[model samples]
Target chain A: MSTPLLEAQGVRFSYDGRTPVLPGTDFALREGDFVGLIGPNGAGKSTLLHVLSGWLRPSAGKVRLAGRPLRDYTARDLALHIAVVLQREEHTFAFNVLDLVLMGRFAHGAGTLGFESEADRGIALEALAQVGLEGFENRRASELSGGEYQRLAIARALAQQSPILLLDEPTASLDLAHQRHLYSLLDRLNREEGRTILVVSHDINAAAAWCRELALLQCGEVVRRGGPRELLRPEVLEEAYGVPVAVGELEGGQPLVAVRR
Target chain B: MSSPTPDRSQARRTALWWALLAVAWLLVLGLAPLAGAAEISLPRALGFGVPEGEFNPDAQILFHSRLPRVLFALVAGGLLALSGAVYQAILRNDLADPYVLGVSGGAGFGALLVLTLAPAAVVAFLLPAAAFAIAAAAVLLIYGMSRWRGPHTPPATFLLAGITLNLLFGAGILLTQYLSDPYQTFRMIRWLMGGVDVGSYRVVAFVAGVGGAASLVIVWRARHLDLLSLGEQTAHHLGVPVASTRRLALFGASLVAAVVVAYAGPIGFVGLIVPHLLRLVVGPDNRVLLVACLLGGGVFLALCDTLARTVLAPTELPVGVVTAFTGAPFFLWLLFRKV
Candidate 1:
C-alpha cells in the first residue's frame, strides 16, 4: 500500500500541559481522501485539526506530512501544501472580497509588493468563481451574510491551490442549500482535482452522505475509523455523541441516519 | 480553471490620486513660508531673483525661520502619520495611534529630563537622541511585560500594556516638573506644548533623513501590514513571520513617532486623524494608504502650523492645539457617519 499523505502517531496536545486535549491520538490520511472527523462538542476535533495544520504543537509524539516530520517544514513550505479555513475571524477594517481572496496567494508569492500580478488576480478570480462568488469581487467582506462569508473563506482556501484542505466547522452557519453546495464543491475538488480534504463537523448525516471516510472521535481519541456506512451505525454514533441515534435507508438505497429523539 | 484578466483601472486611479496629492503638497510648501508674522513677497522670498542691495531681512527670515519650520512640520507630521498607519495595522485597531503606544509619553519624558537637567549648552542633537533611545526602550519594556502569553502577545494585551506605560511615563514627567526650578519648569511646559520652531537647517535635515528612512521601512513591509490586518493567526497561516514582523513594526513605528516627539514635543491628533480620514478616501489597502498618509500628513501639519502661527500674528498657538481644534470635530463627524 502507498504511504499515507499525513500521519499522526500518538500525537498529544494540551493547552496547559496538564490534561491533554488530544491525548495521544493516532490518525492518518491517504492522498486524495475525503475524510470527516465528527464528534460532540468539546471532543477535541478542532484541537486535532489545529495540531494537524501546524497551528498548535503536540506535547508528545509527532505528526508527519508526506513522510517527513511536520515540524521540519517551514511555514511557507507547509502553506504550499495545506490550506486552512478557520471557524471564526474578526477583521478590524473591511476588505473587499477580491482583496481578501487574493491574500490566499500570499504564500504563492502573489502579493510581494502589495500589488497583485495578472496571474495572481486570475487565480483569485477563478477561486471566487469556484465558490460561486464571481460577482462578489467588489463587496466588502465584513458586509457579507453568514453563508456568503463562509463561501468567501472557502474561496480563499481554494485560491491557495494547496494539495490539502482543512476546514473546521465550515458549514456551522450555512443553511441547508448552502451546506449542500459547499459539500458538492468539496466533492469536486477531491474527485476531479485529486486533492485531500479533512473536515471537522458535528453534522453526522451530512458527513456520512459526503465524506468517503469518517473518524468518530470521543474524549480526545478516535473511537472508530471506517467507511461512513460502517461508522454511521446507531451503536457507533451513540457511543460518540452520547445520544440515541437510528440508522436507516432511503428509498434510493443510500444509508440514512438521524437522532432517535 | 481559466485564467482571468485583472482590471487595470484601479491601479491607474490610485496613481492619479497620489499625483494630485503631490501637486497639492508642492503648492502648500511654496505658500507655507509666505504666511508667518513677517510677510515676504511670495516670489522674492522663494529666492526667485537676486535683491538689488542692502541686508534683506525678509530673505533671512525666509531662509532661517520660515523655511526650516515648514520643512520640519512636513517631516514630523509625515512620520507621525506613517507611524500611526503601522500601529493601527499591527494592533488591528482602527483607533490605535502612535501616542496610544506610549512612545510620545516616553520620549516627552526623556526630552523633558534633558531640558531640565542638562546645562545651557547641551547641543540640539543630543536631546532628540536621548528621547529616541528612551522611547525605543519603553517599547521593548512593554513588549516584555505583555509577553506572559508565550512568544506572541495578542494585540489587545499589547495595547493595554502600552496605555499603562503611557500613564506611568506621564507621572514621571509630572514629578520631574515638580522638582525643577521656575525657569526650567517654564521651558518644560513650552516643550511639552510642542514646538516646530526648527530654526536650523541641520535639524531639518536630521528629521527628514530619520523620518524618511522610517517611512521607507514601513512602505517596504506594506505587504506584511496588509496580512497583519487579518489578525496574527491569519497572517501566520498566510506565511507571515507574525512575532518577528510585529516586533519590527512596533520598533519602527515607535522610533519614528519618538523622533517627532523628541524634537517637536508631542503634536496631538495628526497621527490619530490623518490615517483615519485617509482610509475613508482610499480604503484599507495599506500599500496605498501608507503612501497617502505620508504625503497627506505632511500637507496637514504644514497647513495647520501656518494657520496656528499666522492667525495670531505675533503670538503663535501651539501646533498641538491647532490639530486638536481641527481634528476633534472631524472625529465627531466620523463617529456619526456611516463609515
Candidate 2:
C-alpha cells in the first residue's frame, strides 16, 4: 500500500486543561483524496485542520507529512507543501490583490530582503487566472466582496503551488452560485491535478457533492470515518449535530440533508 | 509567475514627477538659508570662492549658522518620517509612530538622568544613543512579557505595553528633573525645547551617518516589511522570520530616531505627520511610501524651519514648536477624514 500523504496519530489538544478540544484523534489522508470534515460548532474540526497543516502542535501525539515528522519542518517548509485558507481574512494594512497573492511565493526563493522575481509574478498571475480573478489583480483586497475575497484566498494558496490544500469553510459566506462554483473548482483540482484537498464545511450537501471520503467528529473525537455514502445516513447526521436530520435523495440523484421541522 | 511589467509609460511619468519635486525641494532647502533675517544674495550664497574683500557678512551668517541649522532640521525630519513609516509597516498599526514604542520617553529619561547626575560628562552624541539603546531594550522586554500563549503577539497588547512604558519613563523623567541643579535645569529646558544649532560639521556627519545607515537598512527590507503588514503569523507562513525581522526593524527605527533626537532634541510631529501625508499621496506600499516619506519629510521640515526663522525674524522660534503646531492640525484633519 502507498504511504499516507498525511497522518495524525493519537493527537490530543486543549486550550485549557479542563475540557479537551481534541482527544487522541487518529487520522490519515492519502494522495488525491477529496476529504470533507463535518462536525457541529466546537467539534474540533478547525483544530484538527490546524494540526494536520502543522500550524498547531498536537499535545499527546504527532503529525507526519510525506513520511516526515511535521515538527521537523519549518513553517515555510510546510507552507511549500501544504496551503491553508483560514476562515477569516483580515489585514491591518491594505494590499492589492497581485501583491497579496505574490506573498505565497515568499517561501520558494524570495528572501526577507529580496524582491519578487519574474517567475514569482508569473505564478501569482496564473493563480489569479485560475481563480477567475485575472483582471482584479490591481484591486485592493479590502474592496473585494465576500465571494471575491474567498477566491482571492484560494488564489493565494494556489500560488503556493502546494500539493495539499486545506480550506476552512471556503464557501461559508459565499452565495449558492459561488458555492457551487468553488466546489466544482475544488473537484477539478483534486481529480485532474491529483491534489490532496481537505475542506471543513457545515453544509452536508457540499460535502456529499465533492468529497469522496468523510469524517464526522463530535466533542473533539472522530466518531465516524468512511465514504460519504456511509457517513451521510440520517441517524449519523442526527447524532453528530444533535438535531433530527432527514437525508433524502434528490431527483438529480444527489443526497440532500434537511433538519426535520 | 511571470514578471509583472509595471507600465513603463506610467513609471516614466512617475519618475519625472519625482525628479521635478526633488529638484524643487532641494532648491528650496538651499535657498532657505538665504532667506533668514540677514537676506544673503543668491550669487553670494552660491559662490564657491570668497570674494576679494571681507566675506559678505550676510553670506557668512547664512553659510556658517543658518545653513547648518537647516541641514540638521532636514536630516532629523527625514529620519523621523522614514522611521515612522517603517514602524507603522512593521507593527501593522496605522497609528504607530517613531515614538509610539516608548523610544522617545526612554531616550528622554536616559538623557535627563545623565544631565541630572553626571552633568559635565554628558556628551552630546551619547545622550540620544543611550536613550535609543535603552528604549530598544524596553521594547524587547515588553514584547517578551506579553507573549502569553501563542507564537504571535496581539497588537493591542503591544500598544498597551508601549503606553505603560511611556508612563513609567515619564515618571523617571520627573524624578531626574527634581534632582537637577538650577544651571542643569536651564540647560535641560533648552534641550527639551529642541534646538538645531549644532555648530560643527562633525555633528552633522554623525547624524548623517546614523540616519543614512538606518534608512538604507529599512529600504532594503521594504519588501519583507510589506509582507509583515498582514500580521506576524501570516508573514511567518509566507517564510518571514517574523520575530527577528520585527526586532531588527524596530531597532533600526529607534536608532534613526535616537540619532535625530541627539542632534535636534526630540523634535516632535515630523515622524507622525510626514508618513501620514505621504500615505495620502502615494497609497500604503512601504516600498514607495518609505521613499516618499524620506523626501517629503526633508522638504516639509525644511519649510517649517524656514518659517520658524523668518516668521519672527531675528528672534527665531523653535522648529519643534512649528512641527507641533502643524502636526496637531494635520493629525486632527486625518482623524476626521478617516472617520
Candidate 1: fraction of native contacts reproduced: 0.46
Question: Compared with the real two-chain complex, what DockQ does model 2 have?
Answer: 0.44
Worst 10 residues of 1 chain B by lDDT: B1-10
Displacement of the residue B277 alpha carbon in candidate 1, Å: 1.0
Separately for all candidates shown, the number of backbone clashes (residues 3 or more apart, or on different chains) is 0, 6
Task: State the lDDT of candidate 1 residue by residue for B1-339, as single tens digits.
Answer: 322325466677689878987887888888898888876875675566756775667788888889889988987888888899899999988788988778878888888888877777874667887787778778888877767557657788888888888899899999999999988889888888887887888887987888788778878888888888887777777777677788888888988888788788888889989999888888888878888888899899999999999999889999988999998899888878874
TM-scores for the candidates: 0.95, 0.90
lDDT string for model 2 (A1-261, tens) is 799999999999887766789989988889999999999999999999988987677778989999999988876798888888888756766677887998888778653443566677788989988878888877878888888988888898898889999999999888888788788888999999999999999987888877888899898888898887767899998877889988888776678888988
Instruction: For residues A128-213, write the lDDT of model 1, one tens digit per residue.
Output: 88878888888889889988888998998998899999999999999998889889999999999999999999887788788999
Query: Which CAPRI level is candidate 1?
Result: acceptable
- TM per candidate, chain B: 0.94, 0.88
Q: Which residue pairs in model 1 clash with each other?
A: none
